[model samples]
Target chain A: METIVLGIGETLVRDDRHWASWANWLGVPAHTLSALVGAAVAQGRDATDALRVLRPGMDVDEAYLARAAAGRGEHLDESDLYPDVRPALAELRAAGIRVVVAGNGTVRAGERLRALDLPADLVVTSDEWGVRKPDPAFFARVVEVSGAKPGATLYVGDHPADDLFPAAAAGLRTAHLRRGPYGHWWAEHPDVVGTADFRVNALPELVGVVGGSPARPGAEPHSARPAFEDGTGAVGGARPARVSYLRGL
Target chain B: METIVLGIGETLVRDDRHWASWANWLGVPAHTLSALVGAAVAQGRDATDALRVLRPGMDVDEAYLARAAAGRGEHLDESDLYPDVRPALAELRAAGIRVVVAGNGTVRAGERLRALDLPADLVVTSDEWGVRKPDPAFFARVVEVSGAKPGATLYVGDHPADDLFPAAAAGLRTAHLRRGPYGHWWAEHPDVVGTADFRVNALPELVGVVGGSPARPGAEPHSARPAFEDGTGAVGGARPARVSYLRGL
Candidate 1:
């Protein structure tokens, strides 16, 4: 059974409005703050600098940021779940797959997931881990806690650099959830899309990619997997000579 | 034969880097110009205002803007064609589909399409039409020139408001080419996706929706078409009584 670790922001929840809400609460122009965050994401850079650039003169402390985010999280309605999320998670869990919610967000994000009655086996956040994603340590913790083989496990996320690339680098099969800020930013970027093992427009589309019966027709199967790899094609079976030569070496 | 009118900008060509290049030539920050264009796109607003916002104080004349855009267009290399483009167009044309290229770009965009040797029967641009997309007249003209019925003709584009929505409103089947600026931006917005008659990631995917042996296995046949519609499914066959009643009325 493959363990599936899912990233929450923009993957499970539509929390883009929260960015603007947080900016409004902090007295920053909503568009300016959103654009800054977008710019950072587009450049594959951390948003810490972009957030700091929002209030150049003011000394915005960590506590203030946390409280503001929590306040915005509180405003998230049940409708925030992408139309396909709940059903997809339910379907994955029903298939006996362990689904986990791990996101680079505050603890409130975890609380919100629980509040929404999402069917995940576990929920983890950067706030609890004391480290954000794209940091190898965070992915290491996720792999450790999930107890799934790094190569066989799957990490589904919306961000190319933060979620897909790092997860792929950590030896996890990566699914790029092409819906949200990073999804929109990276769709045109072939280099980023190349790093993804699977690319899906909706959550339910993952059911097929994860070795179950695909709910959508014509869903591309593990496209990034090489033709010689198992389950991809018969190219691997024809390489007996190469295998024997390698064994002799 | 189904007439396919395709939008050119990010659909057939990658023109994003040109925005930054033009900005660089104009002595403005690249990020600022790109962000302005992105912001305008996200809001479904015309980029004219965003371009004007780039040079607030300067007396930037129309000739300078045209020259700068032309210079940037000149930098576009053969590599700008998405890997799947040429083959997909060839396949569609071979299948007897009348493929047309129409985009919201300067006249140089049309020349670039010709230079790439895209197998488009007719190429049109907003500059030549004296109108831009999302305007009903532009689509009306495309239908007139192509000699295809509004209901059967397919207009493929990336922008939601500028391409898909207006084409849908104009009674043409709309395929939201899920690449480029709008593909990512609107992927999360369900309301926009609803307007598209077909949503596909690659240009080759369009071959399946346009009526051919689908290149991809399990490809949905015109997934956006309503269940009762003919050519999509047999559900319309089950509605004989309703059809008879409507005919009597």
Candidate 2:
């Protein structure tokens, strides 16, 4: 793979604190907020849309400002990252693959992600780009920023609707991380289960998806042996498949 | 190209009458509405967003209802079809390319398009899908319905921000149809100017972009000779290029 664009929440970092913080601010029980978030996700809507359901006509931006004033705004740190993030990112970068961490987070969240100094060429959030996921513009921005052609690039995320489907639609290869609630739930989605280019449980598996990296097996590089080359991609008869693991995984 | 997903407005059909109808209903000169629509498009906002600018907080749905109540609801017929649309679509279909016509039109527009019984395999509108273009989901729907992989499908549209860029992001090959104001205006956009896979002045050019059809040159069909192959697509080194007719036309 020429590049791997990772989704921030749930892919690179656990969103427990993030959602809990919103719950705390909204004066709702954490479980209540979490349940609502899950419900929203199950319906293929934005996670924060749960907030709209909980409070009609809620101004999320205003609420964010209110939370900031109350000393509880978007924040991130090394501890928030999944265990596989550091090693996988480092290995991918070592393999010469550009790594970008982008997803539906806030401007402050973007700042926090940058501050964490993740092993990524770029770290950004939806708010920073003034757009959100599932919108073609968000993925367009990701591809634009990565400087990789849509097919040469890969988008790794947990959410099926927000991440995998959109990224796939935007012409980027997709790796569905089978972690997080959305991941597990959407993994069974007909489209994701049947067509995802790479189905990985952890970030480290991506190194394999892109092909054995120099930092690992040192096999022929992915760029040299493109996946989906002859329209016999992972899902044969679909489009181009990468590297041809072609397994359900 | 396994499939060609043609955009509705300004691609297969002109939007003059549609916009004029809205202007008439809104009690504004057609020129005024047209100018405002262009302004919205130039700003990279939805064309209907111009209505919001014309009358603050105007409920477009409500306005449509009002107009419909006055027997001036959404309407379309054979007259709206651009002359190139019929022959281009018919030739593409005869050549075995799945043709899908989809774009940001209303439910009534979808019915009207279906009523036209265009040569396209499917005719759909954004309202029918409950999602609008510039949204990856829309393109994803186009791919899903066409049963073609994103890379194998070509999304032809006139607007850069709405049609070309977003479709490119979603992994479908993009052809910027140089027609109407949005087409010409967005064509000069740095991304569009430098990167659109196929820049065609007419739908007939798309047939060539896909490669010589049997009805024409009788050369190898487009699906038989994929563009963007070997990372030298229309915009070389971007993704898969179809037929290597990379040009700035």
Q: Which candidate is the best by DockQ?
A: 1
Of the candidates shown, which would achieve the greatest TM-score relative to the real structure? Answer: 1
- TM for candidate 1 is 0.46
Question: Whole-model lDDT for model 2 versus the true structure?
Answer: 0.70
Listed in order, each prediction's TM-score against the native is 0.46, 0.44
| Docking quality category of candidate 2 according to DockQ thresholds | incorrect
DockQ for each of the predicted structures, in order? 0.03, 0.01
Q: Write the per-residue lDDT of candidate 2 for residues A1-249, one digit (tens) a residue.
A: 698899987898877677768867876434345545644444445666767755668999899888888888777888788788999999989988999999988788888888888889999899899999979999999989987787778899977767877788887877788666556544544566544666776788788776543211222333222222233333512432422211121
lDDT of model 2 at residue A223?
27
Chain A TM-score, prediction 2: 0.83
Interface residue Cα RMSD of candidate 1 after superposition: 12.2
Candidate 1 ranges beyond 4 A from true positions:
A1-249, B57-75, B212-249
lDDT of 1 by residue, A1-249 (tens): 378899977787765456656566655434445555554444444554445544444444563567666764345557777778888889988877889888887676667767777888888788888999879999998889777787668788877667876787787877777566556445434444445666676788777777642212233364232222234332212222211211111
Per-residue accuracy of model 1 over B16-111 as CA lDDT, tens digit each: 456656566655434345555554454444554455554444444463467656754345557776677789899989888999988886676667
Q: Model 2 misses residue B116 by how many Å?
A: 0.7
